[model samples]
Target chain A: MSRLAIHGRDLLLDRSARGPSWLVPSLEVSRGERIALCGPSGSGKSTLLSAFAGRLAARRGSLQVEGCELVGASEAVRRAHRLATMGQALQDAEMISYLSTVDNVLLPLRLAGRPVGAAQRARAHDLLARLGLSDRQHSRPSQLSHGERARVAIARALIAAPPLLLIDEPTASLDPASREAALDLLFSAEGTVVFATHDPGLIARVDRAFDASIWREP
Target chain B: MIVWHAAALACKGLAATPIRAVVVVFGLALAMGLPGMTVRTASHIEAVMVERAVRTPVLIAPRGSPFEVTLASLYFRGEAEPRVPFFVAAQAVTRGYGSAVPVLVGYRASGHPLVGTSADYFEARGLRPVQGRLPAVLGEVVVGAGLAAQAGIAVGDRLRSDRVRPYDLGTSQPVELRVVGVLGWSASPDDEVVHADLLTLRAIEGILHAHEPAGSEAAPGLGASVFLPVDLSPETLDRVHAHGALEELPVTAVLVFPPDDRRRDQALGDWADHPELQAVQPERVVSVLVELLVRVRDLLLAWSMIVSGCTLALIALVLALWRRLRERELALLRTLGASRSWIALLVAIEAGLLLGVALSLAAGFAWVAPVLLLGALG
Candidate 1:
């Protein structure tokens, strides 16, 4: 599996100009580790994940993802980089309410302007099969169970086979069995995965744990 | 393949969000209907104007707007009385410009119009009374089909004319006139008026003379009276003497027919330049009305364009933000190795397709609208 390196130095985030919390004071994660971000509530742990995903701007930091330094990169360049190498499974799932499960899975192919031939469809089917969710190929996200939803989300995230995958508390809605199943699926799959959560069960299963309270609120 | 995929995706997504589709459809329908109603109202006014244009060819009136003269003579919807000597009408007929007809109408019956014109009006349009006789005596009258429907008047029915004082704004006569004829249904413009002889109109004013103050050492006759339907050569018509007072005996207009071909063109061409007569093409007037209608429709089209632009912009903004909100979905798409331009293009094409559907529906509405209006008016 190819690795995704995340290196940020002295990142400051603010929702406003004058007074702002330091979302990530400093953080570094080299490639090839299943890292868990752990902290009490409101400690900028999620902001670190968001910064890695480029959903927000960090005031002061050098961010390098897979050796592409994005400290002063253009929005277009960042978008291309994200589209090519980053995979994010959101906390809220963000499933398109109208589209079916299979269409949703193939949307990345449609978005990338790649021909979705028989091979891509079969590959998607195989990925869905890994989560024991082959039957939900036509089911909407709403109709799926919590465990099934988590698996669908995982399949959607891993669909494009990105080098770095970012998942935010995938186990929040899942039972213990489902959480373990989701964790097993997330860690065993290829790539450098950075998942943030305080769940002890999930933390014990990771290769590294980062205590995230060291970042200061500006 | 790309367009088809976008269309399918748009339809599916819109189908999934049924409430949004319903809201948009209702909004568009309301936007189209309000302007359509305004256009239909204006068409009814133009229709009434078109009917009046067929009867009279030239109007001899005081220098005023042609619209006023046409309205006064044709539709009788406005002030139709034009102050010009009655001899002007007679001159046209006598000179072989066209046959002359005298029209005097400024009264209503139960909100329906009552016009006093000569039998020459019927001769001009080839209308023969299908019932009873034309207005012969002072109290005799003829009713039209629409007026009959509106007033419940029939042949032999004695309809009372509301009387006015001298110089009063009320109708001319107080006498109850008997309807001796009901005109046949012509399905044209003449189906809404009640016609009488020009003499009858003059006779009513003759009553006005009796109401005038009779002073000592004064002549006992009304000044310069009568709206006459005259016939003579232009040379003879020009020779006739006019009363010193120009306001009295004003003919609303004259419908003339020249006796010779060369004289007719000369007369028509001459009349177009004449100070007394306003020779207007009825078709041109109607064409102007049609042009006005086209302008109104063009204005409606412009407004529709504005609304469409606003709707498209709003939809684009909403869909763009919606895409943002659906980060997981896009992320899944991106993870599939999709290009950014491709995703944006799919969205753009989807919007274009929806606009196409709306335009087709608007066109269908525009086509169906006129026929429905005609049916309702008829």
Candidate 2:
């Protein structure tokens, strides 16, 4: 069985004529793998994650996620594929202040036009409990501690059990203990994780690391 | 189902800032409701005034504004309007032109107008007693059904007239009236007054009184010297008399119901040359008044439309600012894979719900405000 999660060749980032840009010559990720895109602050790590999520088009590439082409795909097609195959747990970006913790978890299903029935609610509760947020599931984002909010974002990304997860700086503003807990919960999710991170400890904990600084245009 | 889900989400978002939502809703409701209520209330007044005027063929009033005379006679308003002598009505009646019912208004019984008229006034107004017989004896009156209900008066109840100027020692004291009957509802001005014989009301006014006991000579003006006897025994009834001729006494106006167009024309012509009175076709006068009112209403309607436009623009501005504030939240929705149409639909649903509630509130208030206004007017 072919279980490829992401594939790319000549993946371009921010293709502007007179602006900073980069190109990833080749890349591949398998289902259930934990890979870190390691680089400095301006090394296009976040840009590559955005590209994998189909948020923006690449200038020239053969890019695919779970056998679906993304580089030249239409917006509708990209959206459907992304919703079906990927989940995101960006740092502080997915925390909608108006929604409660559990509602935020169920947001993905709502966006996908799927009914959030009893089973779905039970699954969300189970996921939140696994992430050690059972007591804070109904709390608004503003009422949550920073560490608790990060764990909630992870639970939201895992709620749909997508085959691929994209994360940006999951442990950016946390103490050592909170960082460890957040990584523990994230690593437990049943999907391939392609995360951008600057933490050396996290870089060492992942299954493999790709240095994105090598792909810089300079 | 998806639309309902979007609406629910929209509701949740609006609930996040309840004060803004409430302000927007009430502002919209008032903006939409005020004009509609004013138009409806004005139209209701016009319909009532025009209907009454169309029924009374001719009105004989002291030379003054015919509009004020019509208002005084038909609606019991214009208390300061000039009064025509009672002889004008009596002459019209005796000449066989048509029926003439003299009305002596401007007095009140328990805060309701005291309409002093005769049995012919009752017949001409198509008023029938619902509880008891029409007023027949001195010091007796028939109350309008609405007034009876509001004042908690019933047949046989004694209602004292409100003193016109209680502070003035020269004015007559209030006379206690016996409620002999309750007139049925006519949905007209007649339903809010106390009906009595013109002579009985004059007695209350100190114009007529019990004659000074045998040779104590009739005093000048009959002024408060003899308060109307509380109980009108047959002896006292016969003794009550005015010092001057009854024909010269004031009746606010005379409502003439001419049987046909020819008599109406004759009634108009008869008063054309009169020195102190003027005859008017109330229908024509009411038409001119209503036209003036309609013009004023049109101007008000235009003004209200401008106000409503401003209100709508304000609403749009508020919504725009609100949506701009929620741009981050909406972007999160977009990141969750919602389409542009989906986000647009959510915002639209929120605004649509607000407008719908405002429209419903405005309609309900518009429907009820006019009736309350007309009731207050009466």
Candidate 3:
């Protein structure tokens, strides 16, 4: 049996009819594969990524992630599975503004009620350093530049080394150098990657691409 | 381990908003501090009042409020009541029950009560001079330990009584008396008194006069002067006597000590029917006052508790608003796999840290307020 990270059959992308419908309803994501959901703005690329992360429930059809069926699972079970296996960076690069860069990276473990021992702290520091934020570890989100904040958010998502990573437009607002650096970090990350973006150049770097524009009514 | 991490995070979060945290902590401190200090001061006052009353067995005063008379005589609280004859002390002593010490509280020197009593007053109150000697002459006075230290007046220092109306021309002149001794601390109002003899008080009241020869013209009414010069010559002593028999002089109250329970009952029974006098057990009077104080303390405690509850509610409200404002942050935490319980625990820890700091500050304020207040008053 092939090990699949995401398996969907006739999965309705939106729970309400007010949103756009899916053009290609069947999809499969194999382990260690880099899949990009590409489309124009409002074409539902972020929505598909959110669905894969289990943030929104499918209106109908079968959906499974890492061999676990999520279509009818309880919210708690889905959340638990997401926390244990999935690392996600949303569009806003939502960082806890009051926390320092290192503390923000360690937030997932803290939220999981896991003991943040010296090893965990060192891991967080290493992640920040790898993201070119070693000197900015003690700085608050407000003190960091926009690119720096995006890097902090990415570092936070990957701190736990989840088996599956979900990133939403990770390099949309970054400059060319920062974008290349961010792409380098994302592709180098060890896991199954499903990211949402409209940048065709970024789409060419992934193993496979799913066009969300095909689902648009026009 | 999880709790500790959450607490550390909570502290960091609070440190991020230093001004808001300080405001919340200080609001809680005032909520707790004012009542804490009030209760402490009331407890101290009650203890001192009860101890003084227990040591003093009974009070004999002309018919009036027993509470007022007991306070005035035992605690030197100036209360105006009809004066009883000085012979009452001699009468009570002759009864062979126990000693009767006269207390005349009217004048004040340096804002401290000037108490005129016999030498037995010190013996009855178990007071001993820690410096110099007790007043042995009419022109001498003994200062309380606190009064001596506060006024910086030691043995041989001269103190003048404050006239009732300093600006009034017809009022008696202020009397100057020598401080012959300083009594030890008694932890009661007695430690704030200026102790003198009845003759000294009478002289200050201008009721004692010196006889002058018909040919002598020192001054017309000057012989009735209330001021006592530093030097008391033999002639001054001979002239300054009660205008009439000493027995006819008035006293404020007489502190009576019964030798035994039987004598106490006997004396109480003897004065039970007296139309113009009353013998009261001072402890009973003090207990009533203490009960009132206890009620007041309970009321204050209740108000403080209500204020504390309001403060807690306000904190919860603020936290709720804060939680709402941090929706994205919390949603991010949820996305990161934080359990709802963990979020709740983090909030609780934050509140606990804030309350702990506030209570510590309240305890400090409670400890310091009474000392500062009493010192300022003194």
Candidate 4:
């Protein structure tokens, strides 16, 4: 057993009656692998990332993450599995705008019905400090700069310390130096990382790369 | 515990939109306050009306509408009924059943009704003179506490009754009466009356006037005064007293107090079949009026309830629309691993808090409304 992080075969995702479909004949990723999904706009990169995160179901395929079947599984089972084993930073940076930075970071555990005790508070503070946002912990999301907001989103995704991490365009709005810094933090995180992006610089840092254009229908 | 967390989050969400939250809270307050204030005022009015009626035991008047007779006698409201002969009081007193006090209305002094009765009326009403003394002679009158303060009349001041048909050349003269005393406050219509003896009221009504002396300045058309002599000479008093007769005197109603329940029943039976008279229990007539008032209150209450129900429904619709607008925020929470039931609980908690604060404000308004209304009226 290679302890596969993700395994999919003959995956098909249809968009609309007249829209394009995403097709994957076969795909496999091993544990602790750093994989990048490289593509242009509307190349089905985000759709593929959504499928891997269990946010979207494959129309026809056997897809499994850490040996838990995703295809045809109930929504509740998929949601529980996602919450327990995966950390995802969505493309929209869906930070609760009213919550302070520190509370946003603690949201994952709170949502999971876990007690945010003293140790949890300490961990959240440490994560904010590591992301260079210790001074802005009490600032609301609206008060944060675009790059700071991106970093906060990253910190929130990593707070639960799940074994599998999925990120979508985490550095899309960052300056060159900030983008490099965010990428440094993402690559240095402890997990089997799967990210979707159009940046070749981010793709070059990954151990494996998949071109989403291959499966995108015209 | 989870609900508490949900409520805390809901509060934060509401606080984010301060103006919308305020609108919702005040809408609920008005919805609740309108009905609350109406019910409170109705209760006060009913209580006051019934209590005043209960104090007067019986009323004897000319054959007419019992409601009008009771209202005129006890509350001093509505048109004065046809006058009953003053001999009715003498008949009741001579029958050895109860004391009868005559009430004569139809005269006004400074917009206050000038009521004429005997000194026994004061004793029956448990009123005492806070100033001089009760009216003991024909030309003297006693003012109620409220009238004394309102009209700014004190002891030894002469107050003129308003002349009936003042513009008519043939109308009788207005009579002047001296204020002998001021009665204590009783918190009833009695406190607003200018009280006098029956002879004085007759003089004010122009039933009695001073005799003009021969070859004097008091000729009928020689710049004759509009007022009769208030301080009559002994000769004039003698002439006026000789002409006055008990059979011709009129009273609006006779307030009778039977010595016991047996005598009260006898008095009721004795007058029940009389062709020209009707004796009524003032309390019974007032109860009927209170029943009508209660029906009106119930109708008002039902209307208020419908308004309140509509307001609550409106609030619910607003909340539902707010929930629809917040779908994205809720979906984000779901993506963050919050359960569906937890989200529902959050919305419920927010609504409950808003209604709770609104209901409290309505209760406070209801408590204060009656006091303010009664104070203004009093």
TM-score, per-candidate, Cα-based:
0.53, 0.86, 0.82, 0.70
Q: Among these predicted structures, which one has the highest TM-score?
A: 2
Weakest lDDT window of 10 consecutive positions for candidate 1 chain B: B227-236
DockQ of each: 0.18, 0.47, 0.51, 0.30
What local lDDT score does residue B37 receive in model 4, on the 0 to 100 scale? Answer: 81
- Report the C-alpha displacement of residue B3, candidate 1, in angstroms: 7.8
Q: In terms of TM-score, how similar is model 1 to the real structure?
A: 0.53
- Write down the TM-score for model 3: 0.82
After superposition, candidate 3 runs with Cα above 4 Å error: A15-17, A21-24, A115-119, A215-218, B25-51, B126-159, B165-172, B175-187, B191-203, B206-248, B273-276, B286-316, B356-378
Name the best candidate (by DockQ): 3
- Overall local distance difference test of candidate 2: 0.83
Candidate 3 has a DockQ of: 0.51
Residues B158-238 of candidate 1: C-alpha lDDT, one tens digit per residue: 765544344654334444566889888765546777777765555454322222234323335546333332212233333
Candidate 2, residue A114: Cα displacement in angstroms equals: 0.8
Task: Give the alpha carbon lDDT tens digit for every residue of A1-218 in model 1.
Answer: 22448877777765457754664555667676788888877666677777777656667777777777776776666667776777777666666666777777666555544577888888778877766677888888788776676666777777778878888778888776656667777887777888878888878888888866677463
lDDT preference between candidates 2 and 4, better one:
2
| After superposition, candidate 4 runs with Cα above 4 Å error | A1-5, A15-18, A25-33, A97-103, A116-148, A177-189, B28-55, B72-261, B270-277, B287-291, B294-313, B358-378
Q: Candidate 2 residues A1-218, lDDT tens each?
A: 45878889998777467877778889989889999998888888888887888887888888888788898998778877888888888766557777788888988887777788899999999887876777998999999987788777777888888989998888886677667777887798788998899899999989999988898888
Deviation in angstroms for B332 in model 3? Answer: 2.2
Q: After superposition, how far is residue B118 of candidate 1 from its true place, in Å?
A: 21
- Candidate 1: clashing residue pairs, number: 16
